[model samples]
Target chain A: MSGDERWIHTPPRESATFDKHAIAEIHRAAATGIYDIRGFGAKRKVPHFDDLLFLGASISRYPLEGYRESCGTEVTLGARHAKKPITLRIPITIAGMSFGSLSAPAKEALGRGASIMGTSTTTGDGGMTEEERAASSLLVYQVLPSRYGMDPDQLRRADAIEIVVGQGAKPGGGGMLLGQKISERVARMRTLPPGIDQRSACRHPDWTGPDDLEIKIIELREITDWQKPIYVKVGAARPYYDTALAVKSGADVVVLDGMQGGTAATQDVFIEHVGLPILAAIRPAVQALQDLGMHRKVQLIVSGGVRNGADVAKCLALGADAVSIGTAALIAIGDNAPHLEDEYRKLGTTAGCYDDWHEGRDPAGITTQDPELTRRLDPVAAGRRLANYLSVLTLECQTIARACGKSHVHNLEPEDLVALTIESAAMAQVPLAGTNWIPGKGGPF
Target chain B: MPTVDLATAPVRELNAALHSLQPSTNETVWRVQNPRGQHAIAVGLDAPVTVEIDGSVGYYCAGMNKQATVVVNGSAGQGLAENMMSGRVHVKGDASSAAGATACGGLLVIDGNASARCGISLRGLDIVVKGSVGHMTGFMAQAGNIVVLGDAGDALGDSIYEARLFVRGTVKSLGTDCIEKELREEHRMLLRSLLDAAGLPDVDAAGFRRYGSGRKLYNFHIDNIGAY
Candidate 1:
């Protein structure tokens, strides 16, 4: 005390455990008598792709010439049981976003962009939209618990089928399409009132566990004459166990969505507190495939917080066959654009911070059901922008692959990567920078 | 009358034969003997043909049928006449579950009982069950008419939409937003037509009680928690 008595002035410091954010949340909950519900992924900082650094070719490996030696980005998904497996020209695909949460035009734009790039787009909970079906050459139909707008004819026409076990943003939680966004078309398809808040069941009504899922897959196969591939999509909480079960259940492809993936609406507490980050989720999912001797045979698609091509290449290096984008795609189609900064400010949030999709008053017209708001987004123009973004991502991924001396994007391995942080080294199972030692997984035996 | 023994023939051959026939083909009446509880019998038939399954069929019988008339002599496993666009599927025996699920347009006649989730997510399909339906029948149904001649199990028509449900017998419990609505002259007429289409015109439409969405839980309200 005598040493500190010289001149020490410390301002009021908030509690580290109960900071301002936590206090504000407590106040909000106390006032509302309910939990905070919001859209988007986890906002809290966690170990991510930036923590891992790629070790470019220097001595032991030879880099491919960038000018002519083309790196193949093509991938074939669901070739195991389906007669007509989806063959993508690129290793990037669009993640499932429901028609209820997104406007019809936004769904169309996504389909157009995917078709232009020779990739696949997915239909989420509410059902398949006519616009999406008309625009997309390859469409993956989702079999969700609610079975809203689910038709066997649509299943037969789909290029692939995705059985969504759980989503990454809220692993065990159900989906919520607020009353404001439930338009006439959305209400008709889901069999609900036009202005009602519709909640989807977390568990499938007919089937319970993985064993039942196996029988369901067989039923779907018979329904479509084994033409379309079956994909089992799971959140990344128990990637090891879930991936193993999905493979055993006769899934041709496994889509692992990490906690960083977006949602239309969920409890804000569940979003930040539940599930694992994509960076930590990939290695374990790959390990399950390797154990079953189905690695690369049963394709794996990782999703959550994928922004640029570097992230995609990193995912492939970690043994993912492809990567899916949801929030990034919305951004590509002018979501949260600076041009709408004034409108966003009027909504009480800035342009880059506008994630209140559940409000149904989106200025960019991507996430609203209002006809006037939706009119702001021209599908043709938005689709071109999305295509440009996808092209840029592909080019960046190719650049990274070429630097790693890989002829194909799938050939990029974990050996060409190092971790910048100890946490990433442990989570991603990669060696630390400037060292050949991995903390938990010992080196060379 | 051509006969295809399903027990000996591969499913692909049988489906291929059904798929190749034109809508106007006169050789439309085909008989499938020894179905032996096989799945997806006469699926994806766009032709205006008639397929007669002589034995019990497994899951997804007559799935995605368009303009095809399918008659099953025995019970169906699950998802009978699922997503039938425009056709008629007649089942002599009971249907396991999800009978006439998500069909946009069709007439599904279940001579015997239908188990749980019967007519689940049904969209514009007209289904008439001769016997009782298990719990959660007509759940989340969009735009269709379901007629049950016998008692309904628990939570009938839970979260139902525009679909109209008519139960001749007592319902154990009504689901959220599902209430007993008055059967007016127009409703009786509509039910009479549906019953006639399902080949059950002898049944009295006045004996049935109409049930539909109460529209109370449509918008979110704190007081509506008990409804859910």
Candidate 2:
């Protein structure tokens, strides 16, 4: 009953209307001033490989000297029926890339690099070149669906054979040759009209399914007189079933590629949409091999975004016998060299943004046919760089093993990891850090 | 002439026996009786020995041969004399696909017929098939000679580079970038030498027509790119 002007309803919450605030001003300052640079590894800032650390022992564990202790990296591929097994010096091998996708000099450089590090380099859909085979101490040849330049003599000459079913970047896709990369020699090997875009067949003309593949494998073995080991490579889709099938199909080794893998030429949709991540794929493949009681008997080589020693350690801990690198190896050999920043800008991209491998107009000379640009990359120097990178990786892996009280790199286990994200927890199959909940195990969140 | 009986021999032992031969200026001939799909017989022979298989072979008989003469009386399985270098291979019956594939240097003669991709990627070798060839024959051929006495399948020399295709019979179709060309005298001369090397009785080299690339697809010119 006080004054009639005041006494309006007194509410628990306040409502006010005012002019809009400047949203872009707050975001612009934060983005440009502090948080602009992109971080390495997976795109998401989840608990990745970095979260897992080794536990060193004080009294219970013994320490091995960095120089005195022996950490062996020898891997034997195709031990099941190969007349001559391939013995490697390191656990990592270079993947199959074509002479057409990369210049002859680039191919030669990869071979020289891999050979120097006591590893192996592979040939792609295109046939093996003399320069590559001559430079490489151990070479693996790929027999693809197109049968491009497939020669029995060359097959016999190779140290090993990999029958390519699908690649991780494009599971159902085939090999692609842009018009620019098609040279006289490349055309001669692929049986295509020269200077035209070429697409390889998805399936081998002679053989159809896995049953026929078994026969084909036998035929290939017979052709080489069982001299070389045979490997079956598959994209990481239903890897459990594929691994089992590969073993049944008489493959001495199984190579599985994940979603993050790169391709010489493929559609952006295929690259981004198809295939599973390597982290999710590895456990299933290992489980399949274990179920067959063939684990570690037939080597499993996993590949995707294997960037450093931590990734290598994680893969091995997850049960991969070895790992193969393609994109990462290319990066190490100056694929996206920062020195070509100006050239990259001209291509409407930055150094890291350049992924026009299909165009064959690579500025860094890592993938191109332009004679002048290719000459910029010195094969000897690039080889030495790759070797140096490999050594650093090996050293870093050794350092981690020492910290964890593991005498060998294979001693890493899933128990050592704690996931910071639900995806990491599910993929790594470990408990979340500072929490008891596992999203997939208890139920999806 | 020596007779090697496959009924009582292993292919490995037979190859070992053949490897122990000495160089002779005179031609040494071996008649292989009852081949019955024997594999890898007389493999990697450097000497000039003539092996006459009386019947069919399993796979890769006389493979990687250098300066030898191999004649199969019947049909062959996959990869017959595959990757043969500097030799002569004559087939009395039909050949399977991929015959003379990746052959570095030699002369391959198919008297009856050839299946798909005959003389695929032939490198410096010469192939003379009396009958029809299958699809994609001479695919990606770098440098070689392929002479067809009969009709050719579709997409013959589809992505052929430098190898030459000579056909006397009708062509079902041509592959990408492969076009029919005028059979010049040089081509005729080359075909004659290949036929002569394969030891076929004189056939009319002039009757054959040549197929080659028009050189349009040799360089990528953005305007002419086709859907792959």
Candidate 3:
């Protein structure tokens, strides 16, 4: 064997080229007690959404024509009470992304993309801006604990309202906008000092708990004169309890976000280890709605790691009325690209390794305030790309629906799926690989 | 003037009645004789009209108002004059919490007292209250002036910036990084203008003290680190 070939089976001490800098950094972090915690999706490598596939239609199931068949993707959110309910042309809507975490251009791009696809975009902690509201044809305004820029005129103008109690990325943790991301405009809008790390409160100042939330809901309805639909959004920790609470609190819609969700910025440990996965959380949320006899009456929107058409279908089958996108949406519009490899290397990362969305030093210009970098993104072209990607997902969903012998996409059911793991089975609430064993089901008192 | 009694009319009908009326130069005064704490009494009126509400009002009275002058003769509820782009809204009696919350422009004058969270998340509006304010007043206030003629509560001006706070009475406590500063001449002039415009008797802008955000919390410092 040649010298290079002989090294393949050689001992680690002689063959391995250790990264001294990386090892030193790890040692320092360990000594400082900062190395124990794992960041988002880093603890264990579970089967990501990409591993799953849908069984296509065959001779056993009748297929529909690609053009002629109707695989409807429309979703009606906040149908229970909102005067101006959101009627999505597609099942996917943009998730709540804040102004303080993102730049005006980023927000505008999202709005433009969603609007082009005839879907809705939501505002986050720092509140809505005139530019965002103007750009988005259908926008959902968030009423966070901070009540950052909440106002009646804006509420009236909004198609819907989402009361954000918690997020999937870091459930129970309040919002944090690092100082570097805080611009003059964002600071002015949120009424905070420029270049300051702003922490949003965990509890609503006016209302303390779910009991008070009901009254708060009534007050909001009164203020809006029963025009806008109110939504209650929560992280996927206690899906059943939270879902019931949401319904009880008179929410027209319930939004449940899973652990795989993205954040502008959060502690690495909190993002990964704190919350339940999207798959596990969906079943309980649906059960809550079902138990309350409010299923389909009060819409359920699920989010977190929903990347492709299959993930969308799985969520729908598991009982979500619609799916919302955050990380995937950014990806569709080019968040981390190969072209930004050099910049990523400068930050000691690659395109895929880039997770410093909150640092405002995004190499791809997808999440930055730097004028030179931001100018790299052409809003119009990016919007069109997103719209196209959305169309492809819709087509894929339709293909699966046709194969499953369902005329419409909403006809997908949980029985159509089988779990690959115990965690997946628990979350999807589906039967295990071979046996019909569901862990929590049929357990004696 | 057309009189629509909210006691019998639904919120929509009452608002519709108000919206139908054309406020002309000849008709400057509008008297709501039987205003029984109706919510959103005068919402989104861009006309330069004067509405004198005779009774107490529920949440968001005269919300998103522009050019018009709304005078509530009795106590007001939460978020009174919320998001008023322009014009003036006057609450003659004690107002509930969150008075003038998130208002971007215009002047909201509360001649009596205000409860907690008064002017919370205030944008550019000017608010002048004659009595005490409860906890967390002017929390996250971005800009504009909040002049409380009486005592202020704890956590006042928490996470505040540029937004000036002028109080004449005792301060219960201050919020994180919020400190009491000396009232400068410019601040005094601004306070005087606000008082005069609101038609309130001058209560010594000198007696009133200034409160603002300490620049230390503006950036995250390695030394001053603890609970985020």
Candidate 4:
């Protein structure tokens, strides 16, 4: 007690490298002999959109009245080659979250919410669900490596098709759906045993590389009768190269997912260590597009840690045609709710930190496949909540755009942004705040 | 039978023509000329029509075919009959890599040798390679049967799930979690039927050895760490 009391008086110092969390993780690894697998994105704080601030119009530039003036948020995707392109009222779209990872009601809610906002919702690894298809007005079908539930009929019925090359949470890794979540319905869809741990392949079984991808895209186009838009989705590993390759492969749209993008289940190390931040990726992707003279021709959709309208506006300014949201959408529909604190505590977690989605025991009824917990979420109510959140995001983006004197959200350029930090200035390709100096690009003082 | 010359018209036009056919259309049979290796020929056909391509074809020949029977009379390039939904795709000559890849339904009868990753990710499709198949044949195959009459290359049926592999000849090496299983009567019957449908009714199903998932890697465990 004397020795402990003396140490407590001076205040215990925690090592930055080996903090409490790291020590616990080491002990856990030593005991379990397995790497920690969890849901959600990187928890580490990286250079993000928060590092940039918008410059409000002043004496030199006039600000439009937010209440009176209008700011256009509408965006069109997949216009390059497809006979039919998708037009959305807002630039915010729902990212791919598999029916296997999420409850059917949650999938329906996502579809309903996106439909309410006049945007698109996407199908994930396990395939398109009947409920999601019926609920969503515009749906994008994902062609993942597993090809689970990949039906030609569904492909024909889809508004767009996204070829998933990699996921942001684990760029070079495959998807893992623990046996706990692989219910009978999910198993049937994926053509697997009901309770087996499903591992999706990292690469497509048929084709390899950009040259092969070109032919694959052509095959998809042929299959859809050139009717549906074809999108190429890549994790933010080599955005510039990937964007260029996607363009060369005849993609109508390129969907870039950054490190902060969430996954249903992956190794925690892979989630935190791999992939670049969205802030560092968007500019390079845009540069590639611009270099190819395919900047707006082949649309780009950015995802990962995009929380509010400012992030949306920032993404659009950085040359992304739209922004897709996964984690935020789940949060909007009441995932990790504070009201479920008791349930979270039971799961050995807190409300905001409950990321054990792979366990399939989500108290909010969003991530779990357990019937009791799933029944807790009413699709209509959750859908309405998601729609409300999406509306707020759109409004917030418009507010920023209007204040910057831009008639359209797309008009908000790099000139309207300044980085609060040097790292952000270089990554965002914008000047530092209170100075004309850009880290890489020398500017007038 | 109506004939379409690919040299004169683009593959797109031929595909468009094929797509234009309805279920009740009188054009029940069609022929393709100009043996050139063009990609995506006779793709996305949703009718019960029979398409006979007289020569070699390139990548994704008869891809996503539904109801239609596409007969490639010569050697085929990559991804032959990929994602075929129904009907049959008969390749007369040696086929390139990933033959019948991810096809959900239908029968793919390759009369000649098939290259690497043959029938990879097969989802309920029945593939009968009369000759040999190249490396990694039937990798991660979810459902269906791959009946190889001749030898199979390395890593056959790697990480396979539910799919049945019946090989009459030598297998180079079995992939992880894949093992030889007893050729039971039910399997013999299934193989017999597939062989019969592949136009090899006389081949004895008794001569073939079956391989499938050992079920060890189905659930992840630290003990199976070396396999990964």
Every model: Cα RMSD to truth: 3.1, 8.4, 4.7, 2.2
Tens-place lDDT per residue, model 1, A228-288, is 9999999989998999999999999999999999999888889999999999889989999
What is model 2's interface RMSD? Answer: 8.4
lDDT of 2 by residue, A1-445 (tens): 5686466766565333321223443475466542121111223222345644334445766656777676666788898889899988877889888888887778888888899989899999778999899988999999887667776667878999999998787787776677877778877666555677665657654445687578667766655667789999998888889999999988999999987777887755567667777877787788889889998888899988888987787777778878888888788889888888999999887888677876777877878877887787788888888877777777776666666566776665665455666787777666778676655763421
What is candidate 4's CAPRI-style docking category based on DockQ?
high
Give the DockQ (2 decimals) of all models.
Answer: 0.37, 0.12, 0.24, 0.81
Candidates' C-alpha lDDT:
0.89, 0.76, 0.78, 0.93
Off by over 4 Å in 4: A1-9, A442-445
User: CA lDDT of A27 in candidate 1?
Assistant: 96
Clashing pairs in 4: none
Give the lDDT of residue B147 in candidate 1. Answer: 94
Between the candidate structures 3 and 4, which one is better when assessed by TM-score?
4
Q: Candidate 3 — which residues are off by over 4 angstroms?
A: A1-68, A125-137, A145-158, A184-194, A198-229, A442-445, B19-46, B63-65, B226-228
Model 2 CA lDDT for position A126: 75
Candidate 4 TM-score, C-alpha based = 0.98
Worst 10 residues of 4 chain A by lDDT: A436-445
Fnat by candidate, in order: 0.31, 0.09, 0.22, 0.76
- TM (B chain), model 2: 0.91
* Best-to-worst ranking by DockQ: 4, 1, 3, 2
Docking class for candidate 1: acceptable
Question: In candidate 3, what are the lDDT values of residues A1-445, reduced to their tens digit?
Answer: 7878986785745323446645665796676654322222323344445433444566766666777778888988877887767789988889998887666667777888889989999998778887788779899999987777666667778898899999898889876677777778777667666787776767665555787678567666655667788999999899999999999999999999988888877767687678887877887899889999999999999998887888888888888898898887787777878887988899877877677777888866767766777777777777777888888777777777777767878888776677776666665667676768776675421
Pairs of residues clashing in candidate 3: A57-A403, A280-A427
